[model samples]
Target chain A: MIRRLSQARERGIPEATVARLPLYLRALNGMAERGLATVSSEDLAVAAGVNSAKLRKDLSHLGSYGTRGVGYDVEYLIYQISRELGLTQDWAVAIVGVGNLGRALANYGGFVSRGFRVAALLDADPEVVGDHIAGLSVEHIDELEAVIRRRGVSIVVLATPAAAAQQVADRVIAAGVTSILNFAPVVLAVPEGVDIRKVDLSIELQILAFHEQRKTDRMTGGPAMAEEWPEAVDL
Target chain B: MIRRLSQARERGIPEATVARLPLYLRALNGMAERGLATVSSEDLAVAAGVNSAKLRKDLSHLGSYGTRGVGYDVEYLIYQISRELGLTQDWAVAIVGVGNLGRALANYGGFVSRGFRVAALLDADPEVVGDHIAGLSVEHIDELEAVIRRRGVSIVVLATPAAAAQQVADRVIAAGVTSILNFAPVVLAVPEGVDIRKVDLSIELQILAFHEQRKTDRMTGGPAMAEEWPEAVDL
Candidate 1:
């Protein structure tokens, strides 16, 4: 696995391609479950919702070129992609902020299915610190560094409120975590070499609203609603 | 607002620019709170995590050209971007599934602050239905169509399981929702006219793990761990 990953690093797969590998992996897993032996790039592309050309190009980064006529072998492709994504070994993950989102994430089956274990949960609230969620007792935030060290947590998920996110991020990074999945709304400033991925729910809705407004404006032959501040700006 | 939007539509902001507008808006909101009436491009870009050049280019899409030395009026920029994103009008959003994720979405305060109202919550399970979450009663899935129409829901959020996502999507689309924010781990097949954005938590973790693995491999000067199937493949 390490050899393949070293090769992957030497080849340097595009970040966009890295992001899509899980999608392809998910599609391939479904195919394997259905008793399929092989899959054409076209079928897999459709399953993953990408164009066939793009899918083939992405797979090429992993040094796997499917046989032209017979297509790609399903099991082999799953194994290859899984190895490339480092999913062959389970990763111990810790989530900070035991709010609704944190609890939801702990209970989410998707992470466990993909070789990720929710090893620890931490929150600052005294009332919430001892609560049991997803069969694990929530530990107080003060034990964050100890919990991470004791449980061998590698990646930390930040679902804390905006005010607490940065402080929690600082403490975790200082504890030697390099990878973070942030669900807080703030843009965290991390030191060099740390990987931070943010998931903001409101941002998604705002993007949808932009397109939805365009559709409504088209139907109405102009802006769908008048501005709250018509005289607010002259632009 | 209508005139500005019509002009904005004519200018046709890049989708990338539209996506980043919210970031700029959030940064500006923080500045506004801090009593910063105006901001230079460089400072604003730093806050929004983008370069000054890119920030200027994105703002240019809205026909905004900051003063050469003084920069932009923060309040005016906020209004313009909000209007462009259609956040000027409150959007009634209904969430389907009412699972842990669904409940999280319902209780999230960020949406309300950004002109999105969680007008209704619907779930298929009788046990979950009728429960109050975030001050709104969880309506039965049978009332999905009715609640959407009655509440004037223009956008739908799907937090359903992978199995039920498509069915709920089809129903909501048929009920006249043109926008959807899907958190399910499935590739939803929606019509071209509809806009669907997916947020897969597991995918994010997998991406982080890929990088985390790479970082570990680099530290170890090779693959961190040996392959489970050394003899499985010759490649």
Candidate 2:
């Protein structure tokens, strides 16, 4: 992981680590808001739903910001983490698909307060291109590359359908964008240096289904122990 | 963590383990499809994007399924994980909120292949309540409890708006449902023994932004070494 971090530093932070930093930041902020001046590794770990050892090791890669005996100053740690995560600077972002999900993202307070700024909204349908959404006029998909380059966008949000996701990703990458947050279900293959993160709602539900099943299994008994008659299987 | 796992097992498998089981299954299935009969811990770990030791440890909880020298049989491991995850049993799931995202979930193919079966579609809006969605009629929210009971639904997917999620959750829980997969951004404070797992798309993006920021900082040679500029003070 450390090697991945160093490589990310030389090129960029590994997409995985980049994804987790906000979770840690949120936990630290919660501690700070609670009037806790300092927090032990264990305290932050629990709040972030991660292990303390891993937290300490992750923090170590950035720099020795925590006191050995006193733990970490919550405010200072927040600033450090924020700085490391580039929260100190604003990032211009473009949304490729101006669908319901895209509109929700635009109106979402979390993205606005954080480092990301939704610079433009684009869609393939010409009828919806000039439509006003979240106070911004939606642009045609033809303007994607131009708008991305003009705005100096480094991050692109792909909310398009599965069929259009790869095409949008290709255009976004061709426009010099390095990081992409994909909501499409398909597995995206990007260049070696580019970073792509997927957020699939169906996949998350399926994962939960797997766990909910286990819960039912344990309630009945072991896997081999069947209590009632099995219903017809569907697939 | 182990203690939490034990406690979770009392209810079912730990939510953490549940989340990873699909990932493991996906990797194992990939191996099987590739015509590989067996995979070592290291090989499986790489495919699953997890550490080899952690993979071995997680598998150990199931049983000593892997040989010390020969590793694990791909098809056998897939079956074991599937059974442990309750994928062997079909779970009837009701999606409450047939909006753009919910409609997408209802149509997704992943759920059918996995343990989940989208048995019902629901909406609070009168106009949409009777509309057809993915071959299922969108039932009114008033019929939620009846549908859940009739279907013997052990799992409920909350794709409702953030404002309505809690109310829906209350109704679902009152109907004896114990597991919830929440897509809304708000946190659901469930009663003990009830499992709630959240998947927030915006949160994932914020996390990615944080790390993307850090990468840019390192490449620019840290704040201290960067050239002094008037805008630096603002950051």
Candidate 3:
């Protein structure tokens, strides 16, 4: 997915701008729900938690410049951003593991609100295979390829264990799914064209810890590195 | 979180390098588990799915330059990265919603493997409030501040509904929590010095949809934009 997002740079839109488009779309959707017809750049930026100047520059990439006085038409901008993000078309997604995270994702209200539909759920455990969840029966892992072919699932979400993640990913790619959203902790290696986006719960916590430590260091004098590295003062 | 990450620049490490530190640490840990004492930059880069030169530069920021012939000491590099990322100390994390997603987070093995501990599970629903999940009782939302103070929870994960996210965020901030990982679909507004990192499942799908749409458009001639914007030619 990193490679593909970088490829977005060649399409006249920067990768950073491609990421922010979803943020803009999400904000616009909220405004439309609130009966907002038009919004100024400053107002939209505030709602999106971004500065007004950066918001304007990002929108310019989509060729969307709001009227000076009227700002941007909320409905039109939603349509434009949605279209740009390919959310206007329905996408079939398959969940490849039926663990707790998979169950949460299957029932998550966010997916159906957009153009995504959880078409299938597969598991290796026979006890869970026939179980019902979120109005869909859990299919056996043996039927993964068949399910993808039958439902035309273009994307697969892997919520399997770290040990099972790579094997599941390989099978899905072989089944012709190009895009993957991985929740496992392992780093998956795929072919050149295949796109994989990993969501590691631990990594996010580590990042938060890094900043928290910095905040603590500021309150104290600095980090206590002398005990760990008594001989190294330069670092 | 954006502001805090950019602050890492003043500490001599780029925000990009700080982000990749976790990846390097994960790779090094795997090598240590396999009883490997040293690793070449090329080998570690392959495990982390990054280029060798980039990996070398990222480590250099930590004052860790691998020996020319012997390469990097696996256990020592792990300690350095862990110290740099503040993973050497434990962080008490309070999850503010007992939904399916929250339950998954509590049960996720990845958290305890690092420096994070799920100290509390909280929710507002009476039916779920007293239930035990992942061996911890789900406390009432009224106890949010008390739990934070009691458990020394410096990080809060908001898996609450979209409508309740902002209010919960306000309470956690008031409770002296500076770091937040929001899973709600809304964009939260936080005061300066508070760091927020959002993980939206739908946004990831939207990004994949954008790239998938581009692939489809390329297979065909071009995107069928004329029907949507007949008057606009330059876009």
Candidate 4:
């Protein structure tokens, strides 16, 4: 048995930093696309919607402080960040759940590129299971384990309904997939070693709503304290 | 002249904290659904997948120090968080780009509730323009300004392809949309005082790939350190 597993936590790059790496990578790539050979930290920060100081700090974690006066070479930085983010190699991804969101995810052109491939699509609905999407056959949910193993899938995308998300997650975990991208509008309980990242549309909306509400509050004086609370919320 | 703008920055709630607030709110709402009247910081932390100490710190930012030992009242905390998150009011959202992802977002079930309504859907394609999705008729993107004004669309979701994203972002920002949730795989440059949040599918996969590669490295005595590096990434 292994003594200690070297996971992301042990790697020393903060989780927040890991999340922002892709942002910087995207910004650098954009510069590269525009034929810019080098980017100042300030310029890249403006592109990434971050400040120059924070951008420098985040890049430092990648072990590349970049030459101070010369700025960062767009292509070299892309390679280093891609290496750190494990985007230099290819990954086969299996997206389970073929509902509208699932279909959308499967059909999304941006889903497959730069070292990520949609290996297979699985859904519980009989009608959807037989359909072809984004060049992959929609396999039945019954073949969940088979498809995962056969495709050598290390990551599973859970787009199942809320009621089915947990069960699907449980099955995928049992099949030895440790990484999951969940789009279901429910919280999934997974084992300790597994990692799950969730994408909920309404949740994002709620966040935007909060800020918009703040704007309305400022315009009309402090969230209209005089108005009665909605009945749906029992205050 | 207008007064102080109520940007999230001015409120002193760090962007990181603002993001986690939604996570906590989701967890709290799940607890309320299960009829939990009160929750200790530890339990809530477990439910939200963060450490209790960090959870306490995040909650403390909300000016809510849930009663020690006695725990936090679930309904009241829900209200506080909901109010702070602006879920207490409805936000009309317009989605531009009626591609597969856009269609899915339009039909997404979890989207309509929680004070967020899908006000309109627009697309640049003439073939896609006249289509109906999620009970809203898809409109032409040329009418983007008209739709934003007439429908009171406070937030715009950009599901357009990478090339079109920046241009569409410019148009929407000019149309008076202050908030944007971008799904395109490109970095968009927005004017000052505008807020943009991005949700990228492949980027998430790339992050997961990093962690998965770590697991492989641990099991295989370190990533076959002998492989030739990929070619020079041209700028």
Candidate 5:
């Protein structure tokens, strides 16, 4: 089933487009749950916080999933988006680093709702190894390889601390995982054909801070902000 | 200083591009720290994990800051990016929810490096108030209003659990914060002009899991895989 979907993806869809499909799926599901059977591009766009044109363009890439007169059939759209995102298949995920963030991710309600299952929970510390988290018992990090093979887990989520992320990533990759969702701050160097997506909280915060700072700066007319040339600075 | 940058942003720069200025600034600073005086678009793009063309386009939105032949002056580029990001003025930030993630952000080096100062930490827990964390004392949630006014805090970082997130966000908005970095899973409703950026670790992980599932399905051509879809739910 998964192979067939990959073949479908290979038939032409870009990965970037695939990533946004779930967001669309979530919005459509919400509309369905609200008892709305059909939605126009405008309605879905507002709910998803995206531009209607972009949404329409994105859906167009998925091949006329919506009607010309009607916007979209909520249930049918949900299934189509799910299929495009490759969410119509089961995926067993292994999570490393059962710390606060790790545990939070494991316990996150969104993960279970989107079609992914947490097959294994792992921690390096012996103290946390025997602990039960989100209905799954935390396993020792040493058992990662065996568990990955046993569960046939292909995707790994790294919620480890910055210092340990790379090491954990290395071990996970060595265990035969092909895709990684990194929550740690540092970058992970993956071999060709492997996919890595990073979610750095600090980085996101910094980006927001930058904009916030700019907004505040504009409100205050201070001369110290004289035009400066663009130059790289050492941290 | 911040005002000028904000005006510049309003003039024409895309909000998405504006958000990346701080990242470029940080990367430039890192390069400078290593004694680098100049960097090409390619070099900086690699450090930033962005394509050279996209990086160039983002910078171009801020005006032609980079020289065609010389690439970009390290120090000059850093200054320009920092100024554009409004990092020249220190931003007083209030961190709500003194949980593990909050503590981690409080201790994070990125914030300090980019002109964001942790002005106050607040929590609803009575026992946590007055406790020292990372050199700052955690204050009671009741004091949020007073602290925001006294310190002129303009940005709030919501690291609270989902249950308390909306309440915290409401209070923060009422206290006059115009920009928020929400780490909570829930959607925050803010008045017009208030910016809210969310970082959902679980959502990101689930997106990766979706792709991982596709990979596995593609690898194994089994008929039973079609039945795996209904079981592969994400929270």
Candidate 6:
């Protein structure tokens, strides 16, 4: 994992920049769909909801591709960001635990629109097994290693309950899947060389609540830490 | 939104720091659950998976709360972070799109533990409407404005299809939801003072794939942009 990171560092693209690349890519894709051939940094920034100068700085790190006045060629820029983000290659993904979240993930359009293919879905529940979702049949957890090996799934998505996350993570790691996107609300412990990214709805909501509190604080003009909830938002 | 932001600034907490407060809170909560008392910056940083120096800087923004020699009181730190994150007061949330994703969000335990109450669930589909999920009966989309008004739901979770996301966002915004956590694959346009945060699973997967590609590049010592697959991950 360190070696992999060093390679990104060697190219001088900060992880922050790498993360935002997808956001920009999405915005650019939208413009392309609208029949726009080129867009200025400012316009792209507005679409991507980022500062133009910051966007310029980020793109500069990738190499000077934007023009002085013509801005950036939309299709060419799309290829550049997609290539940089490794979307040019198809990646086989296995989603473990065919629960609500897993089912939603399977049906998500963004994955297919990009290069990610949900190759397999696995669940422990006998009731959920043998179910067809998004054109793929849900397999039992007993078929995990076999399915992973057979399907050549390099990435795993864990949508299991918190109690089962760690065990499933361990098993998937042993099955040779190196990357995992976790949604189980648990702190997963993976050995060296594994890459895990967590998307916790609770954490996201808490962050929003912090801002919501700030909104209330401004409205009441009281103490910043006041215990009162702001009145109904009429705005 | 600008007013609320200014209020947050008045309290001297940077938005970037505010974004990370939940991470520290999560790490601290995990430790508290394990019955830890005092934790050094390095220990806490490791648990939070952030740079220790950066972590110290972030905490310093909060004040001289963490004692240098003895580290920080785990419970106190949790309280500080929680209060800073506005988790002390319960915020009611209504989720639109009672699809698979909505069901998963309703079942998630982290929300309640972090002081977010899923007050209502709404959906537009005739089939999904009236179905019981995660103990809440899915309400028709017609009740959206009324429910938001009646239930005092401050946050809206958009899990609708891409085609319906923008329309749902418009209605919710009109109904007075200022904070939105969007799970749909579309970028929502909100009026000023309203906050919108998007979570795109496809983008996350693409990011992991970038690192995975880098890992493979290191192993092969070949060009980073190999046009062919490594062939182990079939399908």
Best by DockQ: 1
Candidate 6 regions off by >4 Å? A1-10, A62-68, A191-193, A221-235, B1-10, B35-43, B51-73, B221-235
Worst 10 residues of 2 chain B by lDDT: B226-235
Candidate 2: true contacts recovered, fraction: 0.23
In CAPRI terms, model 4 is classed as acceptable
Model 1, which residues run further than 4 Å from truth? A1-9, A221-235, B1-9, B221-235
Q: What does candidate 1's lDDT look like per residue over A103-180, in tens digits?
A: 888988875677788989999999998898998999999998777777777899999999999999998888778899
- Stretches off by above 4 angstroms in model 2 are A1-90, A95-147, A158-178, A184-203, A218-235, B1-17, B218-235
lDDT, residue B99, candidate 1: 87
* Docking class of predicted structure 3: acceptable
What is the C-alpha lDDT profile of model 2 across B1-235, one tens digit per residue? 1223443233444556656666788778777888999999999888776789988877767766788889999988888887776677767778898876687667655445666677788899998988876677899999998787777777789888877998999999988888898887655757777888777776766766665655555576542211221121110
Q: Score the docking of each candidate (DockQ).
A: 0.32, 0.17, 0.26, 0.27, 0.24, 0.31
lDDT of each: 0.84, 0.73, 0.82, 0.79, 0.73, 0.81
* lDDT, residue B35, candidate 4: 99
Instruction: Please give each candidate's TM-score.
Output: 0.91, 0.65, 0.89, 0.83, 0.74, 0.82
Pairs that collide in candidate 6 are A152-B234, B1-B193
lDDT of 6 at A50: 85
Error of 6 at B50 (Å): 3.7
Instruction: Find the 10 residues in a row with the least total lDDT in model 5 chain A.
Output: A226-235
> What CAPRI grade goes to candidate 1?
acceptable
Compared with the real two-chain complex, what DockQ does model 6 have? Answer: 0.31
Question: Residues B94-174, candidate 1, lDDT per residue (tens digit)?
Answer: 889888888877777764566777778889999998898887788899888877776678889998889999999999999
Using TM-score as the measure, which candidate wins? 1
Cα displacement (Å) at residue A152, model 3: 0.6
Shift of residue B106 alpha carbon in model 1, Å: 0.7
Clashing pairs in 3: A1-A196
Please give, as one word, the docking class of candidate 6: acceptable
